[model samples]
Target: MTAPEDHDYDVIISGASVAGSAAAIMLARRGARVALLERRSDPAAHKVLCTHYLQPCSYPVLDELGLVPALEKAGAVRNEARWYTRWGWIEPKAAPSGPELPYAYNIRRSTLDPMIRSHASGTPGVDLLAGHAVTGVIREAGRTVGVHATGPDGPTELRARLVVGADGKDSPVARFAGIPAKSHENERFSYFAHFRNLPLRDGITHSWFLEPDVAYAMPNDDGVTVVAVIPDKKRLPAFREDLEGAYLDFVRALPDGPAIDAAERITKITGTVNYPLHSRRAGAPGVALIGDAALTSDPLWGVGVGWALQSAQWLAEAVAPALTGRGDVDRALTAYARRHRRGLAGHQHLAADYAKARPFNPFERLMFSAAARDAGMARHMHLFASRIIGPLRFLNPVALARASAVNLRHRGGPSPAPVHLPHPTP
Candidate 1:
C-alpha cells in the first residue's frame, strides 16, 4: 500500500452524511481546514429507508446554516404531527401550558442528503473526498492523529489533530478507537417505503399507536409518502418471508385513518429485520462520534435526524475552543462527551424504556388515555411527543398528581391496576 505524504487538516471527518456534512459546513465557515471523506462515490446518494422528518426546532439550525431556502426550493413541506392513539388524535396544545414549539417538517432523505452534501462540497475551507473507504484510524502515543483510507489512487493517509467518526450506526472509527458503548436491545423490526399517488390529509405527519404495534405516515415533497411499520421482533420472520404483504397488512391494521386509506403502494415494500435500537457514549482520545454512531435512539419517536444535527451542533460548540487554540484537545473531547451524555441521558433512557414491549407506565397510560378522551389533553401530549416539552415538564409532581387523580376517579377508587399490553414479538 502506497501511503501519501502526511497531510495535516484541522479536522478529518469520516462519513459525509448529515452530521458530518453539517459539522464540515459549520467548521469550514469558521475558517477551519477540513477534509470530509465518504465511502460512496456518489455524494448525492440517499438512504432509502429513513423517514426524513425534520422537527420544527431543527429549522433554526438549518436557517443558521443558510439551508432553509435551499431545502424549501427543493420542495420540502412544513408539517405538524397528528398522533393517533387509542385515546384520540392529539393536537398541538396552546402555550403557557404546552411545549415551546409545536410543528415540524417532512422531507425525503433522497432530497435532503444530496442538498446537504452539495452545500458541504462547496463550502470554503472544506475538501470533499468521495469514494474513499477508511481502513483504520492512525494513533500515536495513545492519541488519535489521523486516518488510513483507500481511494481510487490506492491507500492514502490523511493526518489531522482531530479525527471525527461521523459514520452511521456501525462505525468503524468508533470500534477502532475502543470507545465502550452501552447498549439496550429492543425487540422490534421496521418495514418502510416511499409511496406516491397517496391522498394525504393536509401536510401533517401521522403516527398510530395501535396498542402493541406502531406505524407512522410522513407526507413529504413531490407527493411522496413514507410509511414505516415497527412491530415486535418475533413477527419479523413472517414479515420477511412476505415483505410486501406484511407491510400492507401492518398499515391496513392501524386504526382506520385517511392517510392510510389514501396511500397507494407505488414502490416496493422494504423491511429491516430485527432492527436493534441502542445508544452509545461516543468519545475517547482524539476521536468522537456523532449521529447514529454516537447514539441510535428508538426511531418510533422520529428523533434520529433531529438528534443527529443537534449532536453535531453540540460537538462543534464544544470543540470550538480547542480547535481555536484555547483548551487541551483531549480535555475538550472529554467535556464534549460529558455534555452529550448529560443532555441526552434522560431522553435516551425514556426512549429505551418505551422501546420495550412492556406494560405502559401509569403516566403514559393516563396521559394517552386522556388524550383519547379530550382534545385539550391530546394537545398536551403532542407537545411532549414533539419534544417541545421535556419529560420532566410533563412528568412533574403537579402533572403526575393530576393524572393520577384522574385515573383514580375513573377507577372509582385510589387503587387501579396497570394496563397490560402484548410484548412486541422477538
Candidate 2:
C-alpha cells in the first residue's frame, strides 16, 4: 500500500533488531512502506549480552519469515533442553510431531542479528536507516504520528501512520509515549561466557535448578558453548571481588556439572549485575511496543529471541489491515495489545515470581518430581518450558491429577540419590 500524502511511510519501526527487523520484513511483504531505524551505523552490529536461544514455539514464525533455511545454513544448532532438579533429570523423548516441533536453535546473536537485518534491508518497501537514533515522538492531535531522530546526515522527522517501538527494555519510544513499564525486581544477577571444546550430547541445553541459584550450559553453532550462572544476590560480594573465580567455581561445584576446566574460554566473562524484569502497555495511540520493549521477562528461561520473533509477527498481523486502510488503526492496536497480554501475561508473572530467587514452591516440586518419574509428565514439562503452552494449560486438572498419581506411586520408594552441592571451587 502507498503511504498517505502527508506520511513518509506507512509504518516506522524503531530499533532494527530482531523484533523491529522482523516486523519490517513482514509488513513489507504485505506491501506497506516501512522505515526500520537503527542507532548503530554498522550493518553487522550485534547484541553481545544475550542468551540467543530460540524456543520451539518460535519455530513457526521463523519458518513463516523464511529465516529457518538461512539460519540452518549458517550453522544454527537445533536443541532440546535437559533439566536437572533435586528430583532427578527431566529429559523427555524427542517430540513426535514432525520435523520442526522437536527442537529450537541456539545461534549466536553475532550471526542472528545481521542475518535478519539483512533480510529486512533487502526487502522491497523497507528503508533500513542505520545510524538513526530516535530522540522524541511526533504527536499531533494527541496521537503519535511519527518520530524525531538524528541520523548520520542530520536531525530529521519521519512521519508515518503508525510508529512501533521495538527498542528493547527502557524504551525511549515507550517513555516518550507515556507508556510506563511495571517492573518486577529480579533478585538474581547473571554472568556468562563462551567456551570451545565444551561438548554436550546432541547439543541439548542443560539447565540445573539449584534451589535459590541456577546454572545452564547452551551449545551454540561452530562448537561454541555458553555457560552461565544466575546466582542469588547474597553472593554478589564474592562475585564482585573475583568474577571469573566465582563463576568458574560456581559451575564446577554443581552436582555432575560440565567439564568447564577442560574447555577453553573463548570470550571474556561478562553479564548484567542487575536486570529487572519489565512489562509495558503494548501500545498507545499510533505507537506499539514489541520484544523487550513490550516485556522483559527473566532470562533464565531463554525466551527473549523467541518472544521477539513471535511478537513481531503478532504486531504485523494485527495492524496490517489498518495499514492497508481496511480497518481502524486504534482498534487494530487494541487487538494486538489484548492478544499479547493474553498470550504472555501468565508466563511473565510466573517468570517474575521465580526471579525472586526463592526455593521451589510445592507446585513446582510436585511437577518437577513427577516429570522425573514419568515420561508423559516430562513431555508436559518440556512443553511448558519451551513456551509452547501457557501456565493455565500446563496446570490443567488432567496434568495435575497425573502428577499427583506419579508422586503417589513413588512415595514409598527410595528418594532420588542426594546430590552433594559444594561451594565455589577454590
Candidate 3:
C-alpha cells in the first residue's frame, strides 16, 4: 500500500552496505529517523568481489562510530601501507607512532559489512528493512522525496525527506532519481582470493605496482592474506583461457610478490573480468549518492572502502541541519555536492588517468623515483597513498624539491632500499 504523500522517515537510504550503514548511524545519532533498506536479508551475506582493505583515512570515522575497538577485538590488524615500485619499496620512515590511528584495517567484506549493519540496525532512530528491494523513486513536483520498494511480504512505498543511493556502481536509486554518473574506459580486469598461511608483514600492507599491472598481498583479520592482481584488458584472453594460471603468473611477477603463490587459497578465485569506473556528481534536489554510487575509482588503488564510510560521514555532517529543519534542504544538498567534489574530484581524475593502463607519466617518474630514494619524501607521499591527504598537498614544493635532489643525487641511477621484510609476528 502507498504510505501517502508525506514522508515516514527523515531519510531513506537504499543499500545497507558501508556507505548506507555509516550514514544511517550518523543520522540516527543526530536524532534523524533513517530507513535503511537492504535487498539481502541474510546477516551473513557479504560483498565477495572486494579486497576489503580500509585505508587509514577511514579510521577517524570508524572511531566516531565506536567501531575500531570492536573491529580490533575481532582481529583487525592496524598496519601501515608500503608500496613496491620498479626501483624498490617506497616505504615511509616511522613517524612518532602513538595511538593516532596510524594503521589501516584489512577485513573480509563478509565480516565488515555485517558488523557495520548490526550497529546501524541497533541505532536509536534507524529502521533496518532487510530484504526490502528498492525499485523506484517517489517524486512530487519534480523533486525526490523517497523510494518505492518490495518487502518480503509485498510492495511498499517508503517516503522520506531525502533519498540516498548507496546501492553501488549501478545504483537503481541514482537512475530513478535521474542522477547520471560520468563513466570512463575501464582498461583493466581483476581477480583475487583469500588464502591461508601466506607470509605477511604483521604491521605493513603491501602493494607492488609493476606499472600498468598491479598486485597485492594484504594481511586480513582472520590470519589469511587477500592476494589480488589487476591486469590490463589486453591480458583478458589469457585470464579467460586459464584464470588460475594467468592469475598466479601475474601475482608471481610482482617485485615484492610470489609469496601468495606458495599459500593455499581457502576461497574460490573470484573476481570481475570487466569492471567499469564511474564518477557521479552525487547530489541533486531531495536526493544524494554515497559510496560507489557517488564515484567508483579504479580498484587498483583500493580506495572504495575508505571513501564509502568517509562520504557517508561527510553527507551526514553537511545535511544534519536540513534533516532537522533548521536550515534549507536545497542549500544543504548543494553544500554536500560541493564538499564531495572538493574531497574527491582531483583524486578521481588521477584514478581515471591511471586506469588507462599506461606507463608512468613524467610526474609519476619524478615522484616514484624521489619517493624510493628519500625517506622524508616517501613519508610525505604516504600521506597521499594512505589517503590522509589529497594529491595537491602531496605534490607540494617540499616534496618536489626532495624528488629533484634525489634524482640529481643518483644522476638517473635506480634507487633500491635496504632489504627488510619483517619476520612473522606471534
Candidate 4:
C-alpha cells in the first residue's frame, strides 16, 4: 500500500485522549512524525465523564510539556486535597512539620482534554486526523508496522514503526494485539456530574469516606464543582433509574450533607455501574498501551488522570532511545513495561486492597483518628492520601505503633472499632 502524501507518520496513536495527545506532543516535539487518530470529528469535543482531578506530581510533566500555563488559562484550579474520615478532616499540613508536596489541580476534562489535543495538533511533525477510526494493526512478520483505518474518505492506511494504544479501558488495539487484562471487580458504581453555585471549601479537594460508600466534591475553576457518588453495585440499578436524584440522595446522606447544594446541576448526572478496575501488562512486540488502556485503578483515589499523563511520559522516555535506533525495540519495550509496573504496581496493589469491602487496618484507623485530634497527624495523613507517600510509610512499624497507641487511648480499648463516617454531600 502506498503511504498517503504528507501523512507518513513515524507513530500512529489510536485514541486522541489525554495519553494519545500527550504522546503525540512528546514524539512530535522530539521531531518524530506522529499521526493522532480520533473517531470524533470535532476538534473541540471533550470527555465530560471524567472526574478531572490530577495529582500534584503530574504538574512536572505538564510544566515540561509547557501545558501548565495553557491549563491555567483554560480555567483549571490549583487545590490541595483533604481526606475526611469518621474521625475528622485531614487537611494539608504546613511544610517542615509535614511532607512537603505540591498541590493538585482540578480542571474540567471538557477543558483540559481539548487544550492538550489542540496543542498536540499544532505541534510540528504531528498530524491530527479526526473522524478516523483504526480498524486493525498492520504487521510484517510479527512486528507492528502500520495501521489500517477508515477515515473521512474511504479506506486509508498509514505506516509507522510504532503503534500506541491509548483508546482507554476497552482499547481495540489492546484487544487486537491479544494482550490479556486482569480485572478486579468491586461492589460499587459511580455517578458524577458538574455543577455551579456549590459552596466549596477554597483550595481543597474533599473526599468523604462513608464505609462501603464514597463521595467526593472537587472545586474547579469558574465556580464549577464536580461531585461523584460511588455506591455499592447492588444500588446501581436504582441509580440507573434516576441518576441525578440518586446521586443527590447519596450526597445528602453524608455527615455535612451534600456539598453540591450550593451549586446547581449544570450537567446531567452520568453513571457507570459495576465498573471493574483492570490492569494489563502494557507492552508486546511493537505495540504498547498507555493510560486506562494499560492500567485502570480505582477511581476512589482520583489517580486516573495523573496516572494517564505519567504513563505517557514514562512510555516516551522508555521508547525514545529505541525509536531513535540507539537500542533494541523489544528490550526497550520490556524495560518500559518494567518501569511502568514498578512505578504503579505498589499504588495499584494498595488500591486493590482497599477496594475490598473490609475494615480499615490499624494504621488507617490511627491515621484517621489522629487526624481528627491532632493537626500534625492531619498533615501526615494528607500527604499519604495525596499519594506522596507509599503505603509502606504508613504501615511501617513506627507509624503502626503510633496509630495503635492513639487508637487504644482514644477508644479506651486495645481494639478500636472501625468508625463509619457519613458520606459527604455531592
Candidate 5:
C-alpha cells in the first residue's frame, strides 16, 4: 500500500478526530496512502465540553463505515430531538431506519472518538500517527504539497498530493495556507455537566429555547445525561459567582422539574466563554479543510458532530478520483470547496444570526405557535430543527400559508380551548 516510492503519502490529514479519521478511513479503504495525525497519543481521551449528539443525517456514513452495529452494541441511541419552542414542545416522531438513513447515535466522545480512530488505524494503507502535531503546511509554488510536523521522534515531513486540515477551529493547516476564517462576536456562553441516572423524555434529547437562554438535556450512552445551559452574556456574572448553583438552578427551573432535579451530576461543571463561531474558505491549491477547520456554527443546535462526518464524506467523494491518480488534484479541491459552500453557506448565515442571542422574531413565533397545533406543521419544523433541511425551505411561502391557516382555525375556537394535534401520520 506504499505510494509507489514517489509521494510519501496520498493524503496527510492533520487531525485524528472525527473529520480526519473519517477521511483517512475512507481514502485508505479506496487504496490511497494516508497519514492520520493526532496530537494526543492516548486513544481513549474524550472532548469534555461537547453535547455529543450525532444527527440522523450522518447515519448513512456511519453505516458505510460498518460502525452502525458496533455503535449500537456500545450503547449509541437512535437520536431524535425535542424543541421546547415558545408555543410548546415540538416533538416529531423518531426517524425510522430505512434503506438510506439507518439511525442517529448518542454516545460520549470518549467512546465514539476512539472507536472511529481505531477503525481508521486498522484500515490498510493508513498510517495512524497518534502523537504527531502538524507545525505547518509545506508549500510548493504556492500549492500545498506536504506538512512539517513534530512527533514523538522530534520532527518529520510527510509529503502528499494533498494535505487536509481536519484540525478544529484554530487549524494550523488553514492558517499556514492563509485561508481567512470569518467569525462573529459571540454574545453568549455555555456550561454543561454529565449526570447519571437522569430519566430521559421518551429517550429523546430536549432543547428549551428559553428567551435569550437555551438549555438542553441529551441522553448519552452508559446511562449518562449531558445537561447544558447557554445564557446571554448578561448572565455570565451570576454563573461566574456560583458555577454549580447557577447551573443547577437553570436546569431545575425548566417548566417542569426535569430529571436533573433528581439525578446527581457525576462530572465537574465545565464551561467556556469563547465558544468559536466561524468558517474558512475550505480549500487551497493542493489542500482542503474539513470539519471545524472549514466551518463551525452555533453549538446550541448541536450540528457540529454530524457536519464533521458529512464534510469528510463530501471531501472524499469530491477528491477520490484525484487521490487514486485519475483526475486533476486542483480540480478536485475546487469541487470540494464548491460543495462546501453549496451545502453550508445558507445554514451558516442563519446560525450566525441566532448566535446574536436575540429573542424569537416574528417568523419563529409564527412557525413555533402554528407547529404545536398541527401534526404536519410540527413534522416539517422538526426537519429544520434536525438539520434535515434549511431555514429557507422550512419557511417557504407554502409553509407560511399553512401556518396562517392553522392560526385561523385556532382563532375560530372560543377563548383558548385545548387544541390537540391530530394523530401523527405515518
Candidate 6:
C-alpha cells in the first residue's frame, strides 16, 4: 500500500488558493510531501468576484491551520445574518448550539487568498510552485499517476501518488481527467460594489429574500461594506441599459437597507451575468477534485468559501493515512468523496433549487413566516442558514410540526402579501 518511491510527491494539488493551499498545509502537517501548484505568478493575486463570506463550518479548519488569528489580525469581521422576509425580519437572538452568537467571518478574498497561499508556501514538505499550470494529467494503466504542467521553467511533468484538482468552476484538471460536470443554469444575475463609511452595524449582515430576487449588505474588513443585488434574469435588460443606475436603485429600494446614498463608493460595480451550478464526481482513479472542481452551487447561500475550506480539510484527513502507507490510497480517496457527498448533498440540492429564481414554495413560506414570529423557529433557521447544521436536521419532522403550529395560531386573519419593489421600465 506504500506510495511509489520514485514519485516526486505523495500529493500534487493544482490551484493553490483556498482549497489547494489548505490541502497542502494539512497534508504536509501529516508528514506527506505536497506540491502546491498555482498558475498565477504574482503572490498577491486574489479572486475579486467573490462573496468573501465564510460560514462557521469552516472555522475549525482555519483554527487547525493556525490561520484564524492571522485572519482576525488582518481585519476579518464576525457577522450573524439577519434575513428580511415578507413576514418580517427573522433574527435569532441566540445561537441554538450554544450561548455564543451565531456568526460567520467576512474578509475580502483579495486579502484571504494570498494569506493562506503564503502559509502553504512556508509549510515544511510543501513545494509551492507558483506559475505552474496543470495542462493535463499523467495516466498510466488506467490510473492518474501525475500531471503535465507549464511553469516558468517551461513544460514539466511531475509524478505523484495522487493528483488533486482544487481549481475553480471551469476546472481544467477535471476536464483532462474526463470527469464531466452536471450543470444547472441559474436564472439570476448579480451586481455588487464595495463602499466606505456606510452606517451599517458591525457584527450583523443583512439579507432580503425578496421572493425571486435577493440582496445583502455585508460588512467586512477596514470599514469596507459589500452591497449586492441578485435579481431575476427578467431585470437583466434594465441592468444592461443602465448598470450603475439600476444597481443603485435596487439597493436603495431594499426594505430598511443600507444608507448607500451617503456612503462613498470605493470600487466599480462588479457583475456576474451567469454563474451556473455544477456538480461532478468527487474523484476518478487516483485523481480527486476538491472545492469548486467537485461542486459549484448557488452563491446566493454564500457557501463557496466555506465549502472550499471544509472540503480541503475532509480530503486531507481522509487521504493522509493512506499517503503515509497505512492503507489503500484509492480506497481512502473514495471514502473522502463519500464523506463530502454525505455532508453537503442536501445543502446543494436546496441551493440549486432556489437558484432557479422560483417563488418560495409552501414549505419555505411556512418556515420563513413562522421564524419571523417565533424565537425558537428563528434560531433553528439561523442554524441552518449559517451552515452549522445540515438540511435533514433543519427540516426534521419536529421542526416542521412546530412551524405548522406556529402558522395555525396566526390563522385568525388573512396573511399579508410579500412586498415587491417596482422595477423600472427598460
Superposed Cα deviation of residue 298, candidate 2 (Å): 0.5
RMSD of 1: 4.1
| Overall local distance difference test of candidate 3 | 0.83
lDDT of model 3 at position 131: 98
Sorted on TM-score, best first, the list reads 6, 2, 3, 5, 4, 1
Task: Give the C-alpha miss distance for residue 316 in model 2, angstroms.
Answer: 0.6
Which residue ranges in model 4 land beyond 4 Å of their true spot? 1-7, 96-100, 240-242, 405-426
Off by over 4 Å in 3: 1-5, 96-101, 201-203, 412-426
Candidate 3 residue 22 C-alpha distance from true site, Å: 0.4
Superposition error at 104 for model 4 (Å)? 2.5
CA lDDT for candidate 6: 0.90
For candidate 3, list the clashing residue pairs, or say none: none
TM-score of each: 0.89, 0.96, 0.93, 0.90, 0.93, 0.97
List candidate 1 stretches off by more than 4 Å. Answer: 1-7, 93-100, 259-263, 373-379, 405-426
Q: Write the per-residue lDDT of candidate 4 for residues 209-323, one digit (tens) a residue.
A: 7666778888887778888877656566666676666677777766664555656888877867766789998888878899999998888788888888888898888877666
lDDT of 1 by residue, 243-310 (tens): 76666666765665544555566777776665566567667888888888898888777777877787
Give the CA lDDT, 0 to 100, for residue 80 in model 4: 76
Candidate 2, which ten residues in sequence have the lowest lDDT sum?
417-426
Residue pairs with backbone atoms closer than 3 Å in model 4 (clashes)? 187-233, 196-263, 197-262, 197-263, 198-262, 198-263, 254-423, 258-425, 259-425
Q: Which regions of candidate 6 are displaced past 4 Å?
A: 1-3, 95-98
* lDDT of each candidate versus the true structure: 0.75, 0.90, 0.83, 0.77, 0.82, 0.90
Clashing residue pairs in candidate 1 are 87-372, 88-372, 233-425, 234-425, 234-426
TM-score of 3: 0.93
